[model samples]
Each structure stands twice: as structure tokens, then as C-alpha cells.
Target: MQPGEPSARFVDIELEPGDLRLRTLVPADAPLLVEATSAEPGRSLWGPHPLGPHSLRDAQAALAEWDPAAPGQFSLGVLRDGRLLGAVGLIPERPGSIEVAYWLRPEERGKGIASRAVRAATLWARDGLAVPRIWLEIEPGNEPSLRLAERVGYRFEQRVPRHCRAWEHQDADRDTWHDCLIWTFGTGPA
Candidate 1:
């Protein structure tokens, strides 16, 4: 990829997604990271996550010793003029398949940022990584997110029942389940 260009990875598919730049996630983004994590009631809705401030320093410290191209679990920071809008990441399911996920700040909602980010990711998964399918897991109540998956070239392929538990929103033992809407795109950019 050219300078300022995103990689073929799910998080950096766009060769040059103008305005918004996909940059390597650095440890110094701890404060902004803290803000985003604390924006929602739950740090994350997919699984058991901390309910308060995150180990920003520790996470950043760890990133310092890691390599982005090492192998698995790649995460990228979505930035616009150095401001953190959100993040995009890839979670490999197996040898030739992976799941893509992303999150944007509440204030950045309705700005098409998620779709662009997903598009970049989709392109990477399909073209760069040579992956066959890309799945996006969204909460049942997140209508905007659900629509976003479709808008970005993903369609509802299946409804995974009780796929996730929002341990923070609902009681940990309540079995607060969320349906996972599966979306897919072409062999290339979705």
C-alpha cells in the first residue's frame, strides 16, 4: 500500500479512503481510548468486559512490544486529522476466514463512518486476505448498526440466537441474549 493508504487487511482495505485515515494503533492513544470505552454503559456488549476505566496505559505498553503483522487479532485506529473516531479490527475464525468488527463514537453516528470503515475492512478480507466471507455481529437492538451492515454490502444471512450476552446491561445471570445478524459481500469490496 502507498503512504497514507490502508492495507488490504480488513481494517485497512481502502487504498486511500480520503479524509479518514487508517493508522496503526499506538499506545499513546490511551486517553482517547479511555473516552470511547467509557462512552457506552458497557465497555463492550459482546462479552464479559470491564465496566469502568480501561488499562489504557497497560494496553499501550503491550502494543509497544508487539508487531502488527505478527499474525492474529489485528486492530487499527480510525483517525481524522488525528482525532479518534472509532476503530476497526479483524478476528480470524480459521485459516481462510475472518470476522470483521468496528465501533464509532456516539457523536460520530449517522456520518457514514462505519460504512466506509467496513467497506475498507471488507475489501481487505476479500481481496487482501483472500478470505471467502466476512461476518458482522450486531446487537438486536442496534437498528442503526444492523442497517449499517447491510448498507456496507452485508446482508442478513442468519440470526444467531443467543449469540452474545450483555453482561453489563442485563444481569450477568439473566442470559441477556442478542441475535447476531450475519452479513456478506462480494469476493472483493462489499
Candidate 2:
């Protein structure tokens, strides 16, 4: 669906599976956002915007900028027992596709939280939004994210060179880029 479509309304929707609740992030989550992102600095570079919020004020600004109602694009807080664990974001890539990006707290990794959260979001995008393709762009060295993508049904597609602008090289006179492993959902292992 295109932006502003009637079915793009996802701002108020909440995906609750078992004890996990995926809901729209709010300003109140700034502290958790800062805390979670601070544990691993590189986690910020995985999103569409390589530079993620680092301070509470920055987190608040990031939360405020997230528009869940904007067709096929949204960031949802992954909460368990009302406490923020991480976030799952669906960013529109094209007319019928979206990219799924997620990150969990350091302590929350390896507990199946990311898998469940991704599955929930993917299901929503597939059934709720009628989105046909869902994909992920993971850095090659990020083993955890690579494993999680496969475990959640996203198959490795290809590696695109210079897919993302290096966050650390933003000020360099010459361009510096990084490769990203593309993984797409709804296909068997490659």
C-alpha cells in the first residue's frame, strides 16, 4: 500500500504474543532506549539511519519522529512485563515491500525475544498490511543477527557492497561504505 492509505493505520495497534507486547514507542521510553543502545554502540548503525539516538534527549526526539501511521513504516517497542526490551521497525522500501530492523538489550539476547518479536512484526506486515516482501540488511560480522534472521525464516539473498554509509566515516573527505547481507522472508534457506 502507498503512504496515507486507509490500511496504513498502525499507530494504535499493539501486537501481544504470550508475555511480549509490541506497541508504539513513546517519549517515556527514552531512558530504556538510551540504556539499550548504549550497551552496544554498533547497534545503532543497523537501521536506515546509521546514527541512532545516544542520549535521553536524542532518544526522545527519535521516538517523537517515529510515525506508525505512515504506511508500512513504524517502530514498535518490544516490551515484556511493561518494561522495554528492544524495538522492531518496519520501514517501507517500495510499493509492496518493507525492511525489518530490530535490536534487543544486551542482557535480553539469546532468549528468543528477538525471534518472537520479528515473527510478530513480519506476520503483521504480511497479513495486516498485505505486504508481500519483508527483508533485512545485516552486517556480515553480526553473527547473532545473522542467525536470528535465518531462524525466523529470512533466507540469505545477497551481499551488496557499499550498501550503507559508514557512520564513523561521515566526516572523511572520501566516501567510506560497508557491505550488508540481504535476507528476505518467505523463502527456504539459500
Candidate 3:
């Protein structure tokens, strides 16, 4: 497990508490993914056009891109009683550290699910994967996510100007960039 190496250990594992489990997303979960991402907040966060998979085909195509065994990234679904609520993604950012991002069904927001899921994932990254550092890169205007990061015990580290740039999904004609706030979890070696 060298620094910045993706852990294959995440490929077939499930993090559990019974009430809410984090597991790998399967093709069968595409419909649920579409349902969760088809609404507000998710629509904006995940899209600007096509508005996040209007059909099963679209959702499955998107799901196909998530490779659990890929070199430096993986995504898991947040499930409660077999119902998909949202997803959490982990991407290696730099040596000895990884960045975590999450989103929930629009209707599921503010119920503390995000905090619990994040805590579980970070704990797994530290204890299960031996990752020494975990980070959350959030947009400055996303107040909900900022609060969620704090509730999950991440401390504000700094605000980075124009830390990210990307084309709007499926819309190469439009691209955007924004300032990001970096938050770090207080665990493992610093």
C-alpha cells in the first residue's frame, strides 16, 4: 500500500451498522441512482443538462463508469433497508491522502445520514485501508456540505482559489471553475 495507491480491499467489502450500510454500487442499482439524482441539488451538483439520468439506460451508462477496482478511486452507495439514499466517493488526491465527496437524494438531506456515512467511510479509510489522511474539498457556497464536514469532525484547513475546473457534464460548450474549501479529518498521522 504505497502512498496514493488505490486499495483493492474496497472492491468487495461492505461497511455495516445494519441500519445504514455502505456497499459497492451494482448495475441493478441504476434505477435508484436515477431516482436519487433526478431532483434538486443533485440536479445542480451532478448536472446542468440531461439533469442526471432521466432513464435507466442513462443511469446504467453512468454507473458503468464507476470502477471499484480502478487505480485510485471508488464509489459506494448509501443504503438503508435496501433503499438507495445516496453515494460517497473516494479519490486519491495526493501522496498519503484521499479526498471524499458525497451526495444524497434531495429529500434525504438534513437527516444526519450524510454525517454518519462520511464518518464510516473515513474510519474505513484509516483503519481498513491504512490511509493516513482524509480530506473533503467543498465549494464555498455549499453551506450544507460545509456544516456536514464539521459535524463529521473535519477541521477547516484552507480555502483554495480555483482549485477545480471541468466541463459541464455532456456540455463541452460550457465549462466552469470555482474556489474550494479544504477540510481535513482529525485522525491518523498528520
By TM-score, the best candidate is 3
Q: Mark the regions of model 2 whose C-alpha exceeds 4 Å error after superposition.
A: 1-18, 38-40, 45-53, 70-72, 171-175, 186-190
Model 3's number of clashes is: 0
Model 2 poorest 10 in a row by lDDT: 41-50
lDDT of 1 by residue, 96-185 (tens): 566787867777879888788778767766776667767787777789888888788777766788786666455557657676766666
Reference-based TM-score of each model: 0.73, 0.78, 0.79
Q: Is candidate 2 or candidate 3 better by lDDT?
A: 2
Residue-level lDDT tens digits of model 3 in 1-190: 6433444445333445457788767556777777766664434222233554356776676565555655656677888877778878877766568788887887888998888788888877776666888999988988999999889899998899977655455554466778989899845444
Tell me the lDDT of model 3 at 163: 78
**How many clashes in each candidate?**
1, 0, 0
Clashing pairs in 1: 10-121
For each of the candidates, the C-alpha root-mean-square deviation to the true structure, in angstroms, is 5.3, 4.0, 3.6
Pairs that collide, model 3: none
Of the pair 2 and 3, which is ahead by TM-score?
Answer: 3
